[model samples]
Target chain A: MKGILKIAFKLLVNDKGKFAALLMGITFAVFLMVMMTSIFSGVLRSASSVVINIGAKIWVMDPAVTTVANSIPMPDFVQHAVRSINGVKFAVPLYSGSATLRLANGAYQSVSILGLDDTSLLGRPELLEGNITDIFAENGFLVIKDSEINKLNNPHIGTTFELNEHRGVIVGIAKVAANGLFGMPTLYTTYNRAIQYIPSARFTTSYVLVEPKSVELVQHIKDEVKKMGYVAVTNEEFRENISTYYKYKTGLGTNILIMTLISFIVGLSISGQTFYTFILENLDKFGALKAIGAKSRELIIMIVFQAGFTALTGYGLGVGLCTLMIGLAKMRLPNYASVVTFGNLGIAFMMVLIIAIFSSLIGVRKVLKIEPFDVFRG
Target chain B: MAKTAISAHQLVKWFGEGDARTNAVKAASFEANFGEIFYLVGPSGSGKTTLLSMISGILKPDSGSVTIDSTAIWTLSKDELADFRLNRIGFVFQDYHLFPRLTTVENVAIPLILKQRDWDEAIQEALRYLEIVGLKDRAQLPPFKLSGGEQQRVAIARAIVSQPDILIFDEPTASLDGDTGKKIMSFIKDEILNENRCVLVVTHDSRIFEYADKIMKMEDGAVTTIENKSEVK
Candidate 1:
C-alpha cells in the first residue's frame, strides 16, 4: 500500500507544470465554493444576530412581521396583552427602527436603532469602553459597538452626531453581535430615547419581547400570543423564520447553490481532464505493472491514492485561503463575520471528495481497460 | 515433455467482426519446458506476440486452455489470475516499459510491492536484482536518466525481481545495438535462465539466435518447425 502510494505521489509530481496546474484548478474551485457559500452564510448569521443576542424566550409582533429587520410597528398596548398571557413572566416593549446619522463630517450613514427596556436594560450592549450609566446621560445617549466606532467618525464619549436632526451623543462604547440585514451600524439606547431618536406612527413599538416564566411554557405563551392576533415566536423560531425568509423567498440561496455547483463542476473538469491525460500518458507503465504481477485493484488503488492526495492538499489550501480572506475582511469591515462554520467545512470536504472519487473512477476505468499485452505491442 | 512449465492447447484468437474480422491465431498448441531458453520467432502479424501473450496469461484465448505449472490460467477468476500472473509470470516488453516517474530501484520493487512485501524489504530485494543486472549504481536514477541499454537492464531487473517461474521477453533486443543486444542475450542465458525457471523470447533478431536452447518457428499463426539448437549444431 505504501509502495503504490509512493508511486502515486511520484507520478503526480513527476511533471512539475502539470502538477501545479492541477493544484491551481482544485484550489480555485474550492475557494469559489467556500467563499461564495460563506458570504450567504454570513448574511444569514447577521440577519438573525439581533434576535439571537436578545435571548428572549418569545417575541410578540404584528402578524405581518416576517423578520426582525422588516417588522410592522405595534402600539405599546401589545406588551400589555403579551404580559397578560398565562406563562409570561414579563413583557417589554421593544422598538427597532432605521435612521440616518449625520456624522461629524456631515456625511449621512444609515444605522439601525434598537430600544432596550429602560429599567431592566434587557437588551443592553456589552460595554467595551464606557460606563453603563453613560447610556442614560442627557442628550439622546447612543451606545454603539466599538467595532462600529470608525463608522461614527471614531467619536469619544461626548462627540455627537445628529439623527433626524436630533442631537445624538455617543456616551458608551459597547461590543455587540447585532448586525442589520443590509449591514447598517447598530445604535443601542433606552426605549424612551429610541422613540425620540426615530419617531414613527401612532404605534411606536415594533415587537414585545416576553420572558416565559419557565422554559417549558414558551410554546403555551406563543399559542396565547397567536390567539391575540399577533405573531409570537421563540428565539429559535424567530431565527429560523428570518433565515427561511431570506434563503427561499429571495434568490440568495439559489444563487449560492448554483455557484457552489459550478465550482464543483469546474474542479471536476480540471482535475478529471488532467488525471485522464496523466493516465493516458502513462498507460504503458500501468500495463507494464499489470504484466509484471500488479492486479487491476492495485492499479485502481494507486489512481485513488493520487486523486485523494490531490483533493486533500487542494482543499486544505483553498479553505486556508478562504479563512484568511474572511479574517482580513472582518478586520477591515465592521459587519463581516465568518459564516464558514464546521458545517460549511463538511460540505466543502464532501465536494472535493466527490470530485476525487468521480475523477479517479474515470482514470480507473481507463486503466482497467488496458490489456497487459498492449505494452508488448509498443 | 521435460516438465512443461507452460502449455497452450488449441488456442484460437480473432480480431474485429464481420467485414473487419481477421483470425490472428488458430489452433496454436505449444508447450515450453523449464531448464531451457525457448524462442518464438515469426513474421510480423503472424501471431507470435499473440501466442506469447496467451502462453503468459496476459491474453485469454477465445477457445483454448493455458495451463502454467498445472493451473488452468484462463479458468481462474480475474483476481486469482492476477495473483497468478504476479507471483508466477514475468514479462519484459520490447520497449522496456519502465515507469518513467519511478527510479530504477523503485521500478524493480513493483512486483514485491504487489506481493504486499514490506517497503524497506522490497527495496532491499529490488537492489539485489538491480545488482544482478549491473545497475546497482543507477538504482536511484529515473528511467529516462538511463541509456537505452541501461533502461532495458532495469526492465530485466523488474521482471526477475520476484524470481518467478516463467519469464517472457518480447523483442528484448529490438531497440539495442548489436553489441548491446548480444550482451543482453548473454546475460539472460548465462545469469537469469536456470533449471527451475523457463525463459521465453519472441524476437526476430537473428544475431541472438545462438543463445536459444530451442527455437519454435511460426508462420501464419502455426508452428512451422521446432529445432533444438544443441542437437542442430
Candidate 2:
C-alpha cells in the first residue's frame, strides 16, 4: 500500500549506510560465484580437445588409459589390425614418452615426446609461427601456439635447445586444433627419433588418426578397435574422460561447492541482520501504518518489494565489478581465461536473490507481529 | 441521543493470567458523540491507557463489547477488527511517536499512502495538516531534527491527516512543557469543534481540563465520574 511504501522509502533513505553495506555484501558474494563458474566452464571447454588435436576420430589405447591421466603403451602392430576393420580410413601409430626440457640455463620443464608415423594419413600440426620444413627436416621440436615462446627469455626462430638429455633445434611454432589433455607440452616427431632419444621405446602405445566413414559408423569403428583387446574412444569421449578425472579425483568441484556455500551464509547473515534491525527501528511507523488502513498482507508486499530491489541493485553492481576483474585477469593470468557466460550470470543472480529473500523473511515476520495498540501504549 | 461515535460496554482487560493476572480495566463502560473533545483523566496506572486502547480497537477486552458508529467490532473476525481499527481510528502517543527518519510532512502523509491515495495528493493533504499545526515551514525537517513541541504537533498532524472518524490521544501533552501542552490542547480542541469528528484524550495533565467538552475520571480499574460538558472553545 501507499503508506507502507512511503514509510519504507523513508526508513531506507534515513539509514543509508546500513543498507549500502548490506547491498555490498550481496554483490560481493554473487560476483565470486559468477567469476568462479565462468573460469570452470572456460577451462573445461578448451580441455576437451586433447585427443582431437592428434587428428584422431577414434583413439586406440592399451586398455589402461586410466581416467585421462593414464597412457599405456600398446604394441606398434595394433595399427595394422585397426586398418583392416570396415569403414576404416587409415590408422597412424603414435609413440609417447615423458622427459624434462632442460634449457641452457638449466631450468627444467616437463615435456611429452610423441613419436608419430611419417608414412600415415593423419595427425599433423597446423603451424601458427616459424618454418614447418625446418621442423620436418632437422632433429627439432615444434611448440604449441597460444603458448609463451621465450627461449632463455628471448625467442629466436632457429634456437637450438637441449631437452630430455638430447640437444634439439626449435624449428617452428604451430597451433593444433586440439591440445594435450594432461598438459605435458607435447612435441611431435618421427617414430625413429623417439626411440633414439628414449631408447627401449619400441612399441607405440596409442593410434593417433582413424577417421570413420560416417558419424553413425563411429561406434562401429570403436567396437572394432575394442575387439582387438584395446580401448577405443571417440574424440568427445576422450575429453569427457579427462574432465571427469579432474572434477571427481582432484576435488576441484568440492572446493567450489564449499566456497559457494560460504558466500551464501555470509551474504544471508549480513543482509538479514540489517533488515531485521531496520524493521525494529521502524516498528512505531509500521504500527502507524496499520492504524492508517494498511492490511498486514499489504505490508508483506512492501517487504518483498524492498528485498527484490536490493537484490537487483546488488547483482548489477557485483556483475559490473566482476566484469572489470575479468578484464584485468585476461592481462594478468598467464594464458588463463575467466569466462562469464550468460548462464553463469543467471545462476549467480538467482543465488543472490534467494539469499536476499531468505534473509528478509525474518524481518517481515517481525513486522507482522506489531500491533496498532502498541503504538498507543508505552 | 446524540449520534454515538464510540461505545464500550462492560469492557474488561487483564494483564498476565492465572496466578499473576493484574486487572487493568475492569468492566468499564463509556460513550462519546461526534464533534466533542472527550477526556479520560486519571493518575498513571489507573487504566486510562488500557481503556483508550480498547476504544481504539487495539486491545480486545476479555469480556464485553466495543462498538464504533454502532458496528460491534467484537462480533467481527480478527481481520475485520484490524480493518475497523485501521479505517476508523487515528492515534497520538505521549512520546510524540513521529517517524524520526521522515520529515514532518512525509510522516503525516503515511496514513494517506496506506489508504492508497495518489502520492502527490497525499503529500498535499499532509502538508495542509502541517500548516494547520503551524509547522509548514518545518515540513522538510526530520522529526528528530525538530523540537519536542514541534515533534508533538507533527504527531498530531500525522494522526488527523487521514481525516479519520475518531482521534485518540494517549497523554498527547505529557512530554511537553505547560505552555506547549496548552497550545497543543487548544489546537486539538479547535480541531474537535470545527472538524465534526470525535476526539478523546487520556491524560494526567490537568492543565488541559479547560479544553475538554467532557471529562471522565478513572480510579483503580473503573470509571469513577463524568464531568459536565464545557465551553472551552
Task: Please list the C-alpha lDDT of all candidates, in the order they appear.
Answer: 0.85, 0.74
State each candidate's clash count: 1, 4
- Residue pairs that clash (backbone atoms under 3 angstroms), model 1: A293-B86
Name the candidate that leads on lDDT: 1
Best by DockQ: 1
Give a tens-digit lDDT track for model 2, residues A1-378: 556665666677567887797788888888878777776665655555446567567777876574433566677678778878898877777766767677766686676667667665156578777765555576767766544444233435566667556777666676766344444566666665666666454565445457777888888888887888887888777777766766777787677667777876777777778777777877777776675567888878877777777778888988999888888876764345456889888888878878767856876888788887777665
Give candidate 1 regions above 4 Å deviation.
Answer: A103-107, A146-148, B230-233
Interface RMSD of 2: 2.4
Give the DockQ (C-alpha) for candidate 2. Answer: 0.56
lDDT of 2 at B92: 79
For model 1, what is the C-alpha lDDT against the true structure? 0.85
DockQ, each predicted model: 0.77, 0.56
Q: After superposition, how far is residue B112 of candidate 2 from its true place, in Å?
A: 1.9
